[model samples]
Target: MVEIKEKGEFRYIDEGEGDVMVLLHGLFGALSNWEGVIKNFSSGHRVIIPMLPIYTMPLKKAGMDGLADFVERFVETMKLDNMILVGNSLGGHVGLIYTLKNESKVSRLVLTGSSGLFENSMGGSFPKRGSYEYIQERVEYTFYKPETATKELVDEVFETTKSIPKCLRIVAIAKSAQRHNMAKDITNIQIPTLLIWGLNDTITPPLVAHEFHRLIPNSKMRFIDKCCHAPMMEHPEKFNRILENWLENEAHKAA
Candidate 1:
């Protein structure tokens, strides 16, 4: 069963037991983005998916640093220690920043199609409102298979951008991302890390993942063919298999 908890403006889902695994979603996403993977892993491990307020709260100012600070506070509030951190896109960037500052509290790190290492390939422009075509175009950019941009997904995203407050928040986060660069410090990350990328990801692309693997002293990189930015959603079974194997290996080493 999934239990919802709130602390100030932050909300998260906590489920299952044993070692904890915290999943963080990217910009314009909530904890629901990881529902499938969360359910799959909850049977064996404690899974916590936090809804980052950067996207949901009506804030006058927001930045990567602020988001990382929120994660730090969340960890402290939950009394989590040596837990696993898995994040995608902006969430991945926040996870990296958080792990760097609180290395002793994290046992491992997993990043997929994450941003922050370099400038975005999608340019710095925010999605335009009142244009479904533009919204569809932005959504399609994240996928290798354009057909995967189903009607339901496109409509949901289109509706999301229609809200003026949400649009402003999105723009704030995007600008923050453009200014944030952690390439110089990635090498300083000493914890075991896993870098997963989709071979066809155009947003961050596979090249960024390669760079992350090279920078992090103790890290492994894996790529999924014909997949795009959201591999855990586009190719969930394969993604889960890879994650399960990695977790099993870590367990064996610990024993």
Candidate 2:
């Protein structure tokens, strides 16, 4: 298990040491979501995962902009610069907003199964509270392979939804994502972006990836076969290889 640190108002995992690489997770995302990424990249990169204040944020400030604001504060507090941001699902949406607002700080961006364009999130609704089997079914729907939704992962999401306040926060954020469309603002991105999408992703779908590539100039995309929403988890080796090669090529070009 990754050790989560609490300092001031932040709780996150800080590991390795090199150029900074920040990892952001989506709604219902847990530390385990990025376990493969942390292990593979931590050897040569400083990996930081800030536990997004999804459950704790005041319901009024629980939207996309609010989460980006939190990231800004976290970045400032950490005194980080020239960051390489890797985000998945809802985290990708927040990263996009942050990149647009703070372009200089971000040297590169990686998005997978992002939600800013279009997503099939069951009408942007969470499962019925206290229904374990229903929650399991919903979680399984995210992946092409039903077994990808492990018992632990399902239980984690289950426990999270058990709280009424967290449920409210999740609903508000989902609605905010639906309302805040980035089609107009994404064209403003000025840095190199890498989009790694799951070919079988039910949430964002392949068309969404194509749309992102079409909108963002200087962006490249790679699709992993049979992969669903969370490629990093479903196909960690393939995901890592794509990311590693992309990062290396980008660095060489920068040099």
Candidate 3:
């Protein structure tokens, strides 16, 4: 069973037991993005999915550094030690930044379709009041297989984007990403790292993953063919299998 708990300004889903695995979601996403893989992961490890403050409930205007600071506080608040941080998109970026600052606290790192290393080609212009068609187009852009952009998914995202406040929040996040550059600091990360990418990801693309692999000395990269930005959602089974194997290898080495 997944138990929801609120700690200060953040809300998180806590489930299972053993060494901690904290999953972070990207922009326009919540803990549910990991729903497909969470059960499998939770069976063997404690899974904690925290709702990022800026994304969910912004206390103030924050850039990447501010958001990274929030993640640090969340870790301290949860008393998490030697965590395996798995993040997608914005979440992955935050995880990378946090791990760079607090290397000893992270046992391993997993980044999937992460941002922050390079400037996004998808410019920062967002509609003030997005229509269903507009929202659908944006959602469809994330997927290489257009069929994966189901009506339900598009509608869900559309509802969220309809809110003016949410739109503004998204703008804030885009600006933060534009100002921060993690590529220069990625080499400083000393923890075991894994980079997962969807082979057809147009948003971040496979080249971004290659750069991450090159920068992090002790890192490995895996690509899911015919997949797009959200592989954890689009190809959970394969994604989970890769993750399970990597985690097992890391554990063996540690043992």
Q: Which model scores highest in lDDT?
A: 2
Model 3 / residue 239 / CA error / Å: 0.3
Pull out the clashing pairs in model 1: none
Mind giving the per-residue lDDT tens digits that candidate 2 earns over 135-196?
Answer: 89889988879999999989998998899988999888988988888999999897999999
The digit string of per-residue lDDT tens for model 3 on 1-255 reads: 467798678789988898899998888676778987788888889999988875455636555777788888899998999899999988898898899899999999999999977635333346446577777777788887888888888877787778777767777777778667787888988889999999998878799999999999999999999898889999999999999999889889989
All candidates in order of lDDT, best leading: 2, 1, 3
Please say which candidate is ahead in TM-score: 1 or 2. 2
**lDDT (Cα, 0-100) at 231 in candidate 3:** 94
Supply every candidate's count of residue pairs whose N, Cα or C atoms clash at under 3 angstroms.
Answer: 0, 0, 0
Range of the 10 consecutive residues with the lowest summed lDDT in candidate 1: 118-127
lDDT of 3: 0.83
Where's the lowest-lDDT run of ten residues in candidate 3?
A: 119-128
